[model samples]
Target: MRELIKEAIVDLKRNDGFIYVTAEGKKIDLHEAAARGIAVTPVNPKDQVIKKLESAGLHLTDNKFVADLNELISVLNGGGSSKSAGKRRSFSDDEKSKILEEWQKVEAAGKKTKAAFAREIGVGYQTFINWLRG
Candidate 1:
């Protein structure tokens, strides 16, 4: 597991990352990072909060440290989306492709069938079909 982490850190393709530096000043290792639930996340580092921290000479140790501060801010603002919060649900890549394919087939038919689309989702099949038309 430790070896895998070192490989990941060595093979890191971006400057962005979550790193783990041993308290003993040893080389930052990836296994410790994985244990800490690390990943390469994208966000503006020099945003307002980052700027404030940097300006105050409060140096951050790693991405987790920065994310922890972001989470605190989201909680203060009525529990909004934080660094740890999962993003909203939406169609997956496959689902998006399926939707486009279905749409094309329907358009080519020239006569759309008001059938049960959301049958698997909605409570009653008929009700869901009615919704699709509207």
Candidate 2:
């Protein structure tokens, strides 16, 4: 196995509330990168809470960082569910056929790209592509 590197640099200029840094051309959360054995630089001296949490092997989710740990744990464990959480919107076969038929009219009009058409109709771009494939 390849030895994991233990150090990474934070682009302080790119700081956008969440601690994120570039690794191998992709932007990743600093805490997540740290879990993969990468250490981030310029740790804030006054941020003892983060340090304590890290030391305890606890990482906060982007949505609920300021929430109580127990609440966060409950959310993570699926006890406290959000409306959109883990649910995929599925289209019925008749809905799919109607959507594809509408797409044909849109395509014949030649005014929008596939992605733009998907957005205009409120369907996900990937989902629209899948409909086309069928």
How far off is model 2, as Cα RMSD?
16.5
Model 2 is weakest, by summed lDDT over 10 consecutive residues, at 1-10
TM per candidate: 0.20, 0.36
* Top candidate when judged by TM-score against the true structure: 2
The C-alpha stretches of model 2 lying farther than 4 A from their native spots are 1-82
lDDT of candidate 2 over 1-134, digit per residue (tens): 01111122223234554444344434466777778986554334224334444555545433454355666567788795464467676789998899899889888999789999888877889889988998
- Of candidate 1, the 10-residue stretch with the lowest lDDT total is 40-49
Number of backbone collisions per candidate:
0, 0
Per-residue CA lDDT of model 1 for 1-134, tens digit only, reads 45544544453533654334454433344665567755433333234234445556544546776677777777888887644456533555676466546645765786554343343332244543443453
Error of 1 at 117 (Å): 8.3
